[model samples]
Target chain A: MKKKILVIGAGSDVAQALSRLRAERGHILWLTARSQEALQPLLADLKVRYQVEALGFVYDAELHSAEDLMAQLPGIPDEVHVAMGYLGNPDRLDDPKDAARILKVNFSAAVLLMNAVMHAMIEKQVKGVLVGISSVAGERGRKSNFLYGAAKAGFSTYLDGLRNAGFSHGIHVMTVKPGFIRSKMTAGLPLPGPLTASPQQVASAIIKGMKKGRGTVYVLPVWSLIMLLIRNIPDVVFKRLNL
Target chain B: MGTPMSALTKISNWGNYPRIEADVRPWPLQTESPQIARGMGRCYGDSALSTHIVDTRSLNHFLDFDAESGLLTVEAGLTFDEILQVCVPRGWFLPVTPGTRFVTAGGALASDVHGKNHHAEGSFSDHVRWFDLLTASGEICRCSRTENTELFYLTLGGMGLTGIIKALAFYLKPIETAYIRQHTLRCENLDETMAGLEAYGHWTNSVAWLDCMAGGRAFGRSILMLGESAKQSELTQAQSLNPLKVHSTKGIPFPIDMPSFTLNRFTVQAFNQVYFHKHPKGSRDSVVHYEPFYYPLDKVLGWNRIYGKRGFTQYQLVIPHADARKGLQEVLELLAKRKMSSFLTVLKIFGEQSENYLRFPKAGFTLTLDFGISASLWPFLNELDGVVERYGGRLYLTKDVRMNPDFFRRTYPMAQEFMEKIKALDPTGKFQSLQSQRLGIHA
Candidate 1:
């Protein structure tokens, strides 16, 4: 079965992995990312390795409007995967501009993109899949990365409500919560080695989770239990912790 | 889809050693510059690694098929696994296949890969008909033996420096059964092993597993396997009914990386001893599918993980028939003196060299061995490379990561010719990879 899929934030490690796996399954990809230039190597490799057609477009998610972006799609994607993220220095969020950019990039922009794509699929009367990769940090606020976590938390909750809205319309909305990953996005970070996942593993989990129609997934499954334990701690004790 | 994102990421080849945080470039070019094409990441070393590359696996698809002619035209990204899934049921099979099914067609051609049948059939390129190449100029040139003959020969095993392979056309050997009539023999020394292989080399396919840990008179103790495609008439009544059907073994993957200490010399030597003694000196013919006969290791998926997080290095070198004995003996003695042994070591005899300017095979004997990554690995491989140079034998570029540039140039006389092709076609030298940079093959 050849699927026509749209992948946004295609330069991200997890997103690239997802696109690679989908292409192996014989899907035609339409990719959009912050920089089309950055996508050249990946698209070239995809072309030579999978022998599948993949078209790339320049799309910046920080736009205040998505009408122009939606207008550029070849057609409504059979499935949509959104993997855009902005993990800024947490301490720098004290600056109002930095904080606003973080929330806009991580929260509202995703909400807008999903809202538009979901409606487009609905208008077409297509029973399509919509997946957005969030993070386990969103399960609870943390002192080290609370701003990004809060934004992800908002995005996760938004997906939950979208899932509610999508059910009657026959659209599947899935929220993926990944733990630590050693992607290009997290290179050089002080992340514990054992806790990190490769982009392929995360991508595999996303495909498996979407196929299973999991509403909100903790990738690797164990993360779900791990988050549960973290979320259950009282704020009194949590506020003192720096993890 | 809405966020500010950066562009670098960490990636590694099959070995999982020296993971690099590098930039990635995807095509439908936003920039006029060219990037290297990488398919399936199956190479055991950095031959396929680079700062940025075109992920060719996404392009795998069958472009055209002639059922009657048994000719297949597939995009470079297509894999033999997928090819067999379709062809085997139709009484067709790949002309050649490596031990793993995951390698992309582009990677196969780029390496000019040889299978267990090399002694009978040649490498993969010998069976190729034509291919559409996306050259450095962005022109789609049709290349074949009779058309663009020079480019065709060079690109067959050009390691993708020639350009991205858009599509390849090749002949598929017709088959009446998916099973192989197999014969196995156990030999107790290098002389016995060589004799056993020669005796069975007349079969369609032959391969030998050597006990690298054995020393003294038992130095090359091995299990020699020979097989022929079981003919329809050769099958039993029940087997004849399902002759054309091919079933893959459902593999159990290694769940997690094993600890590095698990595959040290002590364990490999013990295992090698037991394996050597397991089969008594004799021959047996058995009926089996192509899966076990051609790719026994595929039964356990992610078998590489057994080498652990640091990964292992595979040194596969070939020496000419004239110096086969002396060259192999030198290399084996080096490993024995180091008290180091490999878990997997294979020996095969080549039939003839490939026309592909950069293809590695010649009329020779090739030995492939794997050693887990350790502090002493790189230095040891250098010493081995020095020995290979003395015998005029060459290491397989596809399995190389640490070979010296001097050794590569000395072993592959085509370096000058291949460089000329790159200079003429890609004047700017836009296509690149770590291997090219390491060997200084491209500007």
Candidate 2:
């Protein structure tokens, strides 16, 4: 069955990979990125490569209201994937404005946007799958990126609640916790080879998880084990060690 | 917008020679001048390396594809592998491709790479309709035959010195199936091999694997492989069901770098002997998937590692048709005399030369030999370069790491003209590579 899918933050690496995978399956795409110029190429690519209908709209999570953005979609999507994220500089925590921006973009904006989409899906009685791309950093906050991790933690908690709430409504919400993705966000980081997953790997995992109706998914299975081990570490020991 | 991150990293091309530490960063959305653009770093030498390199892999995106005319538009960073994955299933194939499908379209244009079918088709640029080049002044110029004609011609095989290729439009040839009807002929010697290549010139694609180590009686003994796109009717019942199936098998990974001593002359000779005898004499016909036919080495991921950590260089040179026979024999004789063994040796005939200023392909017999890096290799190759130049042949810029400026200028008659045009286009010397600097090509 072909799906009508909506991808938020279409400019993101994981989202672009996901969109391509979905388009390859002959799904209709409605994409939203901060810049329509950035989204145009992907839209055209999906349209031509897969002969699928793809539409793009300008949407800045910080600037635009979720209600206004949701209103722009032609139809209620069968699946909605939120891939927007900002890996702000941990060194720049001295500036509260930058810290707030990261928190809002990764957590507040994502929550409001998903809330709007969820309401729209409920109003239309569409039993859609909502996928939130959270991060493994949220599993246990470390000194390296506790600020961004905290924001993702909030987003992950929100998705967990949404998953329970949507269960009664016949809607499925999946939380994706990816570890060390090889994307623009982590381009320069010295990520461990065995631990890092490419955007394509994460995208395919999301699709597979969506198909199996999984509540939560770790893009790389080992990430779940790694996060579990990290979570179980005593605060005294974890605080003494640098992650 | 925040400043993009940059890392001081050690980088080298496929040959892995003369590795240097440079500041490498992703191409900025709004790029500034004076930075060299690199995609996949597949160029054999310094052509893709510079002090400051802008990685274009992030810029990969498909812009458009007109299914009716088979015209596909893609960003510069898109690889042939990515294109084939999408296009082949739809019965469309690249008009021209090099031995490996890992090369980016922009890199292909910059090098003007030739394929097995060069005698039938042409270089990669021959099929290019037009391209959007980000000039030194940050102006995006649409270049083609008529528009910005000189820039268009210069940009092809220009080594990305003229500017960064942003996007390009090229025509894709429609294919009935993905499988190739292959015919192989085992030749006894150089005379027989050359004759075989000419006799099978009518075939859509042709290439020969020559055993350079085989001396005297077996000198230039080779197997000529000819291919034509297999028709649906020619495929077996199992294959006919999915005639357009693209190869999805993962290549066997070359897990570790072999020790330097592992690929010495004796081992290479033994391998070559085994390879040569594997194909039966006379004509043998078979159906093969395009992957193995077009890119046999790609099956061994990081096969270059077989040369070990010191790395190796592929010396690919082409001599004009009139002098080709003598030139090739002289080169092969030198290799045999020196007891220098090149593990992989290939011979092909290119039909006609494109007018593109710096493109390597010409109407000639082109031979490629890969030599592992050794103490004597550098000076030995220099001697070989002299022999090649004497025969009115030129080395492939894409494969070259150490051709002196004088040799480059003498061999490429249009080097001066290319320099003048580039100077006018990029007066500030904004777009230059280590290759351009080494060859004395500057704005």
Candidate 1 lDDT, A94-202, residue by residue in tens: 5887788778878888899999999999999989999988888888888777889999999999999999999999999999888888665564355656667888899
Which candidate comes out best when scored by DockQ? 2
Error of 1 at B305 (Å): 2.2
* CA lDDT scores, all candidates in order: 0.82, 0.89
Give the poorly placed runs of model 1, Cα more than 4 Å off. A1-243, B3-6, B25-34, B236-241
lDDT computed for candidate 1: 0.82
Interface RMSD of the candidates, in order: 9.0, 4.7
Score every model by TM-score.
0.69, 0.95
Top candidate when judged by lDDT against the true structure:
2
- Model 1: native contacts recovered, as a fraction: 0.00
Candidate 2 runs further than 4 Å off: A93-97, A139-146, A221-243, B1-4, B29-34
